[model samples]
Target: MKLKHYIITSLVLAVNLSALAQSGLQKKADNLFNKFAFVNAANVYKELISKNDNADYATRQLADCYAFMRNPDEAVIYYKTVVQQANVPTEYYYKYAQALRGIKDYKESRVWLKRFKDAGGDINDSKFLKDADFINTIFNAKPQYTLKDVKFNSKYSDFAAYEKDGNVYFASSRDEGVLKTHNYGWNNEPFLDIYVKAETDTVVSTKSKIKGDINTVFHEGPLTISKDGKTLYFSRNNFNKQVLGKSNEGITNLKIYKATLIDNKWKNIEEVSFNSDDYSVSHPALSNDDSKLYFTSDMSGGLGGTDIYYVDIKNDGSYGTPQNLGNVINTNKNESFPFINNEGSFFFASDGHPGLGLLDIFGTVSDNNKIVSVINFGIPVNSSKDDFSFFMSEDGLSGYFASNRDGGVGSDDIYAYDRTPQLKIEGTITDAKTNKPIANATVTLLDSNNNQIATLQTDNNGHYEINIDRDTDYYVNTKKEDFLDKIIPVTSKGVEKSVTSINANISINPNTNKVTPITELQPIYFDFNKYDIRRDSTVELDQIVSLMKTTYPNMVIKIESHTDARGTVDYNNELSEERAKATYDYLINKGINPARITSYKGFGEQKLTNQCNGTVPCTEEQHQLNRRTQFIVIRMQ
Candidate 1:
């Protein structure tokens, strides 16, 4: 009986020791996670789960580690396990949905997103829930930038490329001997340090660590320099004056520091006043005028995991209170790395908005300094992996960004990109005499040098569309059997929008002997609220005068003018009348006798060519189509 009691007691003692061992392991893993050492934390959590000790907690931590590392494939594996369990946090459902999106499993992502909302997640903060076609929209968007790999990327993580003067400054985890002792626990890589590629250097080996007292034994980099190169702002671990600051939880946070340039070397390092030891503040950027400083932070009262913030830089060099960028530029997920180009366009990184995958870069549409909407910097600028840290030049034509996508030299590499606006020419082909749609008409596009760029046959509806290069002049030639060829000149210059649409309708004359007299000409357009003839409008109006006075000497025509669906209907009617009279006067002054003119009237917004009848939203191009004058022949001899 005593032997049986002894065996039971020994078994209980064994169980207690095993439980204690697991508790210790959990603490160690949690500590590493708090320090952003996700790789090491994941391994420890995996070991704990292997023993089936504290399995639920270990599994959740393992999922979180992968999620933070931007490894959505692995994250989904473990998140799937934890989310199915009873009493799981509501946030897990949202995280799983995001991971599913990262893998392009959008159907399943929506299902989980709905579940997340049903389980008490805030639907207002969910972008996917608001737009049902968000994924398709992103996939179908025309790429706006051409990306190319830089020659200096290393096998280790390298990113945040900033150009100043003739040098390219960036942050890298590449090994610098002796400083190798400062290896980071996060990815088992050497701590990131500021490095520069001199303008005179032609090879990657010529790049070297920056000369300054800025770098430390801890992580330091991802910096921004002033326009004059006299000041610098950079991110670093919470270490200063040989002292490392830690939060109450013993986690080290990042802080933004300022340095002055003295005799070509960075000196006089000082922390920004807004920094706190409790939360991180990093990724500094300056406005074009240097009147404001932008940064990323998680200090307090933010709407997301991290958010973009800004502070006004007074003329005396003092900073105003830091202000959150608000809901338009932030989300419940992370938003970081704020940059402003010379044109005042705001750019940043976000995983919260709809994107191709993890941490895609986004831009803002600001109206008088207030962000009204956001736009994703679609594929090539974004990939199915982490992409962030976008920086553009003063011209807003070319720039750099960082990505950890496939076919790269390292985990994170800087890529150069040139911005290209999407330009297109589309219209219909019709017979000049009958005004009937002509099907299967051959349309050939030629560049300024008369070289054929593309050729295609119009569809059954007589509609043809083709892409064209930006800021180039092109000629569109339309031809068909028994029809005279028509060549129209189109130029894409001084186009300010990202998408330029040119409508080039072509009317071909029939080659048969029984031909109808030419009566129709290109519509004449007017500037907003103006009735005076423009230089371009004279081209179309002269065609009208020629047809009436010369081509068909007895041609009788009626002029009709219309206005876009804006302002009061009465005002539009009055404006259209003035436009119609302007067209009538121009033809008469150009030697067309008044006897050939039958009538002139304004249609206002009644005869719209498209579906932009005021209630429906329309682009500027669509509105421009309605503000025009057209001439119809009542009788042509």
Candidate 2:
């Protein structure tokens, strides 16, 4: 669960047909895939395709195998093939999009994501596409803080860092005494153990594993230490009492154990009372006052795969019943890695919410148990990979987080950084034609994913301001009745020196009446040989109706339809007449007065606007220009 993977459990169904019909080689591959041995399964699957046997299944499974192993490059090649094949499942489209994004091929990834969305797939529910430009500013902007990889990371999985008592403690799978040779089936690495490094060390030349009964051969320590550093709570598999407890599925569930440091020795290890063999309960975090313990669990009654939960720690030494953190902090997807800073700010990692990728760190503060705003820790604190296990210092200036992003020293690495304030966007809104302030216009702020984040209204002077994250994309949408909507995209490129402010001015055009001979509205279009009104044409028609009814109540309007020189003159004339009648009928349906309509007429190829008449030569653009639905006001009473 800490590895953060979204796997398809239907591999049996995925390869059944091929397994029944294919050679023994494919069956071997299928067996490996079903066991979650993606690294080995991909090789076997590749061999099947190289031998030209059951290439379709091999291609898809090979792609999926690479995807499971987080090899986006290999995954993209095979996914491209599988995604184009007919009857490909919706998940393939989403995987293809993810693979593309993993390789930083964002534009191409968006194409597949759109296809996935159109096919009713979630595509991780990200907003990277909608506010790409706005989000990019955060990437391009100067950073207020900097980060560096921790010096003591090993070639194995090393992460989940915490600092206490002048020592930096972290969980790692590095080879060590008694447990050096042991490896977990999940990742082929040693089980995690807590290692400590002195704060005064310059290059991390020495790391001492915490000596206690706290670590076991199975797994231990991504832990929380109490304020006095006497009590420690850590996560471990349910292998206590030398007995391996298993869930109904025969898999081990994680549990939180409490241990106390006594006379330089950690002893009195006991599992939390609520932990059961039926579900997992781990990732313990203590509040500043030690009155509450927060953790992650998949226990019964949870809203999703896992949720954040808390228990009240009584003064006399007992825990209250666990309470789910509610919908705002928990979603139907996994939420884990709770880390509370000294200032009462809550930080956690979740995949259920919209994020840049697999998991992103989010921060929220609570006042009197009421949740405040949630903030996303933007890049490079986050990446398109699993970023979690966030720990912030007391001053809120520096922190550490674990990530599996590329170029790391191990499967997971801890990064240290100082917090930085980002950028603020300020703007004014006004009428385009009059050059006057437009007050009360709703200005909605949207993130890169097209998710609405905040809404503000322009004041009397048309001024508005909002703080935004760095290296992110956003859209400022200005909307007011009787005025054309204006959307301005703003990006906060991370700056080296802090940016004081960025300004934007928006001028929206007001809807105009048709009393003037020329109007700014676009002409409606229709398909070839089509007489029924197209859906797009109705937009302009609705605007026309609104303008006529509101501004010129008794205006007499004329509908003119035209056509290109594709067919014979008589046939073209007839087609134009049908087009004219369709336009006229639409206005009538909209409750327009019958006597206000002057006439509806068709002027076919005879009144061609370009020399393309009678096959003189014209491009599609010219032909389209000739085929138009135009409106004119004959009289206004």
Candidate 3:
């Protein structure tokens, strides 16, 4: 008996020793890898593996090191060993499949993918299966290289790569970042300029700068060109000898500047005065049509930190007073550098997230003033450091942004990428009766066969846009509680080079041409703060699914639920997300394809046609209508 006890104790000590060794080696590898020493980390991981051939952790680390070093060929071998080792964690299966996909092995990738799904994997992480890089790699037979490094700076020179119409433009710390440097003694860059990179990528304004803009002086950096490359908008600040002024940083105060090309020569360059002396603003982003401007500012009465705001460019060229984008887009954390792609997607950088670092590039899709999918651009675009101020070309196949990670020339140098956003539709809501804009109206965008895609509310001006992809046809339905609902068509033909304004009117008639009339569209309302399928909501979604299933029995519907501006932004967002997902999940279970179903977006307080929350008394019925279920057709084969 004593001999047996000795053997058991001896075995335990061996296991402990092995574990301690593995832990120490892992710590070393992690530290080395974190310090950008990928080769050293790979070596250490290999040493550990050589010591313990059965060490699954060591094997996985080795694979990660190889992948990080852009040696997917080696990573594939290690990852395959781990995957076939069997009984690996489900997450590991995904990693293994991803490695397989990395090596242009989709057929093998599918095998592991099946294991991952069978083992309960998250299918919605589309970056793995749907990212442009992955698509380009698989279909085009190229390598999908993840971001190996990021470097941040006060200025990003890579904006030149994102130039419009063959013009050269970039974000700089030159003499013209802001109108004037205030308390921070920073204003437009006195020396900094959006130095147009010459044919050889030099900061040669002669080739880079527009004739009119070249003379403005002050700092002219961080500039973004219009989608078609016709309009040039940038931040202006007081400047020093050549450095950008702090004023242009959206601090003490900031202003957005604009210029347009008329007869080939740049004309009319000046500052935008919509920013109040009482408030500070910077980082101007113009929408596809050059009609909407999005910026960031610290003008007190906001959601906190810095919030994103927009002002509609009136017909006469004056901008409407800045309107706060609300709590969803403006987290308590600073939201800066607003960017809108040709596809109408909004991208910005923020520290208010679960990212790989300090500030990561986050994005959302807003149409008529409603945001959908406030998500982090993970892995390839984000890292364990700050990566902000992203810009993509007009075609959107290539993107450029600034980051400070491992690979780059210096702090905040430019990085290029191949990217393309899927298609989506956005618009507004109004009263057919008076044609007056309706605020807090719910806009439910459905697809061709009638399925919920996303649900959002209109802004103070009765505007809302539905977020969808190129593969889907859209129907925008407008509804206000206690008011008749109206559904209109919004088609995205891929050639529309501007932000389309789609309007739907909800009306309840007092009298018909001959006598009293009933109504035009049905208003779907909700109970207090609920996302559960109320009989009313069910009736609506059911009507949609009924129409769709009649066309295709094997139809898949995606129901996106929503809520109004009645609670904390984050909490409201969470509730809204739950509401949308619950609606989608319900319909999916009720004969909708779990795969055919696409997404649920919780717009939170971001989309509000009227400032109703915290106000005296917004009708429960109105709030109910504001709370809604939106359907979009995802796939119709």
Query: Which candidate tops TM-score?
Result: 1
Q: How far is candidate 1 from the true structure (C-alpha RMSD, Å)?
A: 23.0
How many backbone clashes can be found in candidate 1? 0
How much is the lDDT of residue 130 in candidate 1? 35
What lDDT score is found at residue 69 in candidate 3? 42
- For model 3, how does the per-residue alpha-carbon lDDT over 368-454 read when each residue is reduced to its tens digit? 456633555455566677677776556645556666566555444556564323233544455656777777776665667665544
Question: Comparing 1 and 3 by TM-score, which wins?
Answer: 1
Tens-place lDDT per residue, model 2, 159-206, is 778888778878887865565667877888888777778887665422
**Model 1 per-residue lDDT tens digits across residues 242-335:** 9999999898988999999998889999999998999988889999888889988887799968888999988888899999999988999888
Rank list by lDDT? 1, 2, 3
Location of the lowest summed lDDT over 10 successive residues in candidate 2: 6-15
* Candidate 1 TM-score, true structure as reference: 0.51
Question: What overall lDDT goes with each candidate model?
Answer: 0.74, 0.73, 0.56
Clashes of 2: 24
Give the candidate number with the greatest lDDT.
1
